[model samples]
Target: MISKLNLENILFLDIETVPETENFSDLDNTKQDLWEAKSRYQRKKDFTPDEFYDRAGIWAEFGKIICISVGYFNIEGDIRTFRVTSFYGDEIKILKDFKNLLLFHFSQTKHLLCAHNGKEFDFPYIARRMIIHNIELPYKLNLFGKKPWEVPHLDTLELWKFGDYKTYTSLKLLTNVLGIPSPKDDIDGSEVYNVYYKDNNIDRIITYCEKDTIAVAQIFLRLRGDDLLNDDEIKHI
Candidate 1:
């Protein structure tokens, strides 16, 4: 199946997000109530909304994107290098820069935005955030009326599932199964919130995001029965 698609046309991506505010206490009373309501289904009974706030980053309404790392293959003769870059900073700036990238370079209908579980998370989150920031949605990310076949989004997790909706697969597990080097050598998703909020380390988050982006691309290649890329072949820009 992967052999049918043009690898160069796919843009692999991953994002790191955090709660809009540093702490639950920072939210206005109305937002605090809203967050509590949103968390009621998922949070443990003993956990207060403030205690559960760290998980808010997974929700588009409650969180803000801090980093959006994207990668694409650059083919030159027999050499196929995967080049990665990231947009980091304030939420508005990050969204705007990413939008610019899409509009300026990857605007073609043949271009695709690929991520792990991107259909459920990264893709929609980016679209919502762009709306919040008053930035127009990039054509590739807009899927209001496009048929399933017309949507140019590729999700590695969905590809692995083969239509089984009940099972869940993490990018880490797929990488392990495919023999791709682990991207979680530093920190995982659970630690990203604290890393950004408490540690005030956006660079670290960008690094982690970039690794995940690369992992997604590698996993896609593996699905195509291709060899994993070496470190020297990964260009960071």
Candidate 2:
């Protein structure tokens, strides 16, 4: 039903993230410390709070967003095309450029932005980073004060709920169930931080991002009953 729900007003987005580190020490100063302490307590069976923070700091220092790939369906051609851009320089500048692109392309449209787990992670991350850079968020993104379900958000993960709140699904597993081809290759969620940190290869990041965007798009197509990808539509990185 979502497919017939107006493709003219949808923007598919995905983000790459590294753990928060710029103000890690500042966490010790506020109520956030309690949350951190609780998280540590929960994960105590694995690692201590200090050790976890230390390891996270190491990844934050080296883990950068190398690429952000965005895909949009071409209504005229009935084809989906994507653009994978790199952010190899300053993180601030990169975030700004990305924000600007969103503003330019999506500001005037009544578009429903969709992403996997975007409600929790990608959306807030981008909004906070934009504020840090003194950039105003675009209209569709100004949903901070709105109710989660009221907003024009189509999180595939949420849809998989199928009327059950406790039924959570991972993107990988959902794609498999839907018969969508999984693009997961040598890299995975855990390896993403390491790949970006250790190799510093933008191409690899771009590949990873493109695959994700494509997967999301395919999921949308299936929900809409539209034709999904054939061999020609796929681009392997």
Candidate 3:
């Protein structure tokens, strides 16, 4: 089924997120209490909510998207290139720009969104954040009232699972095993918060996001029995 889908019709995306506040202390009294309740089960008795705050970005309610890098294929005669770009800076602007892209371009029935763990993470995360920010949900991102088969989002991780849902595989590991070039050359997910907040390196984070997006597309191509893209074939727009 994947082999039949056109690669150019899919929008490969990856997002970088960070806690809404730089530190736990920065949260107001009400938000701090809510954070405690939200994180209590995960933090356990040994770890306080504030101590576990570094991972706040995993939850849309507690965090905000800082960057969303997207890649898509373009063909001109016999030439093929994958153009990548990023929507970043102010969260509202990021969400708006991304929404606009979906509404204006990828809104067609055949268009789809692809990400490594998009079904479980990226897709839903973006939707939740958009609702939180009061941004209108584009047709591609809005899943409400849609049946499972109607959803156009694709998750490479789910495809890799192939009915074994008990375990998980990172994009990095899958790429390594499938012989696709690793995208983790700079940093992994664990360091994103620090890189964004402490080092203040948004460009570095954008690069990492774009790499992951390209890797997602590459992984999908590999799954479909196609050749992996060369570095020279990737262009940042």
Q: Write the per-residue lDDT of candidate 1 for residues 39-154, one digit (tens) a residue.
A: 99999697989999999999999999999999999988999899999999888988989889889989998898999999999999999999988889989988989999999999
The segments of candidate 2 whose C-alpha lies over 4 angstroms from its true place after superposition are 20-39, 50-66, 77-89, 144-150, 234-237
Provide C-alpha RMSD values for all models, in order. 0.9, 4.3, 0.9
Q: Please provide, for model 2 over 10-36, each residue's C-alpha lDDT reduced to its tens digit, 9 standing for 90 to 100.
A: 667676655444334545456346536
Tell me the whole-model lDDT of each prediction, alpha carbons only. 0.92, 0.63, 0.94
Query: Ten-residue segment with the worst summed lDDT in candidate 3?
Result: 73-82
Clashes of each: 0, 1, 0
User: Which pairs clash in the backbone of model 1?
Assistant: none
| Model 3: CA > 4 A from native | none
Residue range 158-222, candidate 3, lDDT tens digits: 99999899989999999999998889999999999999999999999999999999999999999
* Displacement of the residue 224 alpha carbon in candidate 3, Å: 0.4
